[model samples]
Target: MRTLRKYAGPLSDRRFRLLWAGQGVSTAGDAAMLVALSLALVSSTGSASALGFVLAATAVPRLLLTLVGGVWADRLPRQKVMLAADAVNLVAQVGIGVELLGTVDVGLVAVYAAASGAAAAFFVPASGAIVPSTVAPEHLARANALVALTRQIAMVAGPALATALVVTIGAPWVFFLNAGTFAVSAVTLALLRVPAVAAVRTGFWDELRQGWREFSGRRWFWTNATAHICWNLGRSAYQVLGPLVAVRQLGGELSWGLIAQGAAIGAVGGAVVALHVRPRRPLVVANLALALGAVPLVLLAVAAAPVVIALAAGVMHAGLSVMQVIWQTTVQNHVPEHALSRVLAYDWLGSLALAPLGLALAGPLADRIGLPATLAGAAVLLAGGCLLVLAVPEVRRIGSRPHQDLPTAEE
Candidate 1:
């Protein structure tokens, strides 16, 4: 009880609490948008290929602009960036919602999605870099855990709300709700009061180069990211192809959402556990958890029992969330705050570079090799990628060091 009390006080910080609330709302909105968008694509075209293009449009921006976003994150005030980005997002969502009311043009939706996604590309790195500024070093794990929990809750609520809206009101309203969420988030963010770190006077390109230097110079940074590129590629295959498999091969959207929900539930628990227990070798723990995700992919492909597949998926998601919390903490701790955004941008670029390729190829690959065979192949690839990291000495041996350069907080 004493230990628990000692560890549990991070959530009481006022700045973090406001940030957390805003982020929670934004996450829910994003989730709702995802649900509405997916349903819109499926209902309008009834083609997996169409959905793939939409997904690609939404994602490819991050792969392209992540570095630029990072460069700016290093040079500018993170809080201001967040505030401006959310305001931009609010307008974009409203415009899209209004457009959707007139036509079912998927292309128009794609264009709006691309614009919003480009804005999102900048938002992520800045948000990630700013988080450490709001809390003490000892409280990082708890902070990250709270963030993950909010994300999970938002995801669960968002999809459910989207479903109800789609049934009751329509798809256009979902976008309106998304706009409202960003409005609320932006207002809350504007209310936050923290001492601003002055922006450094660095040219964009030079700052970008410096961020790259920091990213590539570290063995642990590149090694883990490289492994994650492979992992995310496979995971992307699941994201794009999984629903198609469920809808066409299994049942329909409801079944697919259920499968996703199972994973989300597991992830919530995983985040909590990660917050409570700080692993020595966070990379090792993260890699092991990532490897475990392959179990469900293989199980779903081979096993005919639906319950078995669902159980495997739940375990996979739970493990993945644990891996994410550890990964976030390690990156934030080791990277300098001034350059953290750009480094994170590089991290996002490297990790997600192949996601579009995976999405593009999954359908065709499944067509040629068969769904079960393709899933089995993905499982093999996921395991192989994880094993590659284990072979690297830095990753295998790396552990959490004490906050030697930073001060610890009192509870």
Candidate 2:
């Protein structure tokens, strides 16, 4: 209990409090949308392959624009950029909600999906860049833990709320709620009293180069991120393959939802553990947990027992959440605050670049290799990729030392 208290640092800091509240609300709303979207698509298409396309659409734009967003984040004030991102999301959500008020077209839904995804590409980089500014270095792990807690709470609450909305109100209302959440977040950010951004005047090409230099120069940064690329590749496969398998081969959408919920609950526990328990080799811990995330895939594919599959998947998501908290803290501590967004953007691109490819191929691969076999293959790939991380010496032995003295912007 004392250890857990360490992770709940005083959010009484005005900046952190405002930011946390805004993010918590926005994330919960986003979760509602996620659940609503899943049901909406399932109702419309009745095919997991089509659902995969929606996920791919969301990821591909992030892959393409992530670096650009990062550059923008570095060049401009992160708070303002976040404000704009939130506004953009608000508009996108409103548009979707309004459109859905009339009819439920798959084409329109896909368009809304792409637009929302593009908005997210901007939002995520900005959020990542801004966090280090909001809290002190010593408090970063706690902040990350708090954010993870917010995310988990959102996950648990969002779906059930979405389910209720869909059953009683409708999917469009979920979008409306999401839009309102973003609006509230934007307003809260506008009220923050942060210091002016440090002027780093550089040309577009030069800024890109500088950002790239910062990103690639850190050995630990690139290696850990590279490992994540493989991890996400396998993850993308699991995202598409797992639910589909549960529905078509095993049970139905309800069963798949249960499986997903189980993972979410386990992830909440993982976040709690990561926050209080500081490992010496934090990066290595994160990498290994993420890589071993593939273990669930083996159970999912090979096992006929539903209980076994659910338990394995729950364990996998638990590890995933812990890795996320560790990685966020590492980035916040290691990278300069001014260039954090650029680095984060590159991080996003590197980690998720293969997601579209994975999603794009999963359907066809499942058809050819059989769903169980393809899932088993993804598990094998994940395990091998995790083991491959041992080759990166920095990953194995880094994050055990103190942070470098980098010039950080004030929040």
Candidate 3:
């Protein structure tokens, strides 16, 4: 009874329902973009480094501007920020679509990717806060679960669909279709009636300093944030390397889609598991769960076979999904509502700090050394990163109860 009710309660809320449905459509488009972009780069250049360049172009801007996004999300109406981000993304997508349809300029595609990344930095921080703003605190865990579920379902369908379209009609139309989804997302946010919560109009730097204090002041917080940084570096490497190998050795876009779809199927199961079981030491479990991510990267490097690699991806993503839920719920419940977006921004900044560097380096290094060796090193670093985070006593002991206000921001 409790299990069913917990899942159904958030969906019953009209506002959450609208946000949930709209986000589902948007996520599918994102998944499709992932497939289309990778295939487009590989098909055009046949160079792994070219693919990495585009990925790096996207990550660099996000890393640079994410803090500014954090400040705005905390100060202004979050839904409005999201709407603006969506509008920016919508225009960027159209640019990419037009460029793809006419003359394929790799440099031009990369520029658009950077623009989209800047918009995403703002979208992500605002999006992170909206759930806590809209849903009851008690139901936040379940609400995140539903969000994960929708995203996972899209992951299952979108890649397969993308590969089919890319194989037949080509990448430009797939990109144009993605532009339409952004329109859907913009419409939903325009209608969203977020409860108006007053924000402090602190000087911009002070807000960042305060958020930094709130974030770095907590030992568990900083430790987990560091862990995320390491994990992202390794994960970005895998994302760039994985698709190239799939297209070259495994069997092209269809195989890439299969591996992605398998991960999505597994992620759905993990999300369902998260909806029911709230771990007492969520940070500890999440850290251990992250260690599982190393497996698929190792599999891809060693096997390079579709069936085997897809199965490994499934196991890896199941753990990834659960860890994501636990981490989000922990942060949302712990941070002060007024400063939540800024703190979340710091968390994002800290976690993704090295991703651009990793994405930039992964291809060039792999070309020089060897793909298998590069992947194996990443897997080793990924596991080592997880264990180091687990070594922190604070992360291991993080309790289920909320810690809304830390004892001291300076401590």
Candidate 4:
């Protein structure tokens, strides 16, 4: 019998190891940037509204142009596209940092945010599609889990480190550090030697249409994507309302922070488990695991104690981590490699369809209907949407057995 490889097995390939290290540093910087930017804006302006504006500016452009980015990634070398995106991101970070140190204007910050978002629109799709080319199909799941493990660690450590940095050196320096990490990422991309995929010559709109057809044809693909739409909508709702519940019912900011830490821990733990075990019905089990995501929201609605709420959040996040690893592996395994970036763009667009609405409506709707009622509705949507997806025959039947993805071979 062949001995199964651990998560570290993917790192045995020199090219993938370089890419993985760069990604880890960049992701950690990103996590820290989130805290640093939010804190810098809020502290300077002394308004919660500034925070929202900055975030919205980033998210909207990223959402709107994601498909176009997909087209470019498919037509060009994905690694080159990533390098260019990283360069843009580095510039944006420097711009924000300079603006923050000088005037602290929200408008200038919004501009920088928009630039960063545009860069991300291209970077994300390229990154997603590049993985299969980096490692064999057999190691895809392990690669994904290891990446998530790095991100989870960053999610936990980044904010705390940023908090300390902000207190001592200042926020602009954090931005500078973030920019530096992107440079590191770009350098690694330059060194990577993955064979170039044959450029598809179809026109942009036609290419996009072709990608859409591919994304829509797979029943398992569309079902899971739809499930993501519902899950993200509800998850966003909980994010908007959960803090309020924390402040009013639970111990407050500190408790909420602790709860978030618990979720991070669960994320890492879940990735570890996923690294070891290959589920037969990956999507079926992923959807089922996603159902656990609703648990914390339900608990929060009931005015559960801090400890209980934290535990629930941990459970919820573990489920999320499991689903993420399997879902990414499934896509890399099944999708045609040449078209993967465009298909991934569609996946991104679909997954985030209702997210903004969820975030925007949560506070107003909760105030009108009450927190408990709003949370209850969110919980219902979360569970109901997951179950609905699981009912699809393709989603239930797709097995997790390893197979070669077209063009995923050394290219």
Q: How well does candidate 3 score on lDDT at residue 227?
A: 79
lDDT of 3 by residue, 1-411 (tens): 976776778877777877887788889999999889899888877887878888889989999999999989989999899889888888888888888776578888899999999998998988888887667777778888889988887877888899999999989888888989999998988988978767878799998887788778887887788778888888877899999889888879899889987887888888887787689888888888888889989987875589878888887888888889999999887777778788889888876787768988999989999999999888988878888887877677767676543444465
RMSD of each: 4.4, 4.0, 3.7, 3.4
lDDT of each: 0.78, 0.78, 0.84, 0.87
TM-score of each: 0.88, 0.88, 0.84, 0.94
- Count of clashes, each model: 1, 0, 0, 0
> Model 4 over residues 287-310: C-alpha lDDT tens digits?
888889898989889988888888
Arrange candidates, best lDDT first: 4, 3, 1, 2
Q: How much lDDT does candidate 4 score?
A: 0.87
Which window of ten consecutive residues has the lowest lDDT sum in model 4? 402-411
Residue by residue across 13-99, what tens digits does model 2's lDDT show?
678888889999999999999888788777756877767777667666767787788888787887788889888889878877886
In terms of TM-score, which candidate is stronger, 1 or 3? Answer: 1
The predicted structure with the larger TM-score, 1 or 4, is 4
Off by over 4 Å in 3: 1-3, 38-56, 105-109, 167-170, 236-262, 296-310, 359-380, 403-411
lDDT of 2 at 367: 93
Highest-TM-score candidate: 4
Instruction: State the lDDT at 346 in candidate 2.
Output: 85
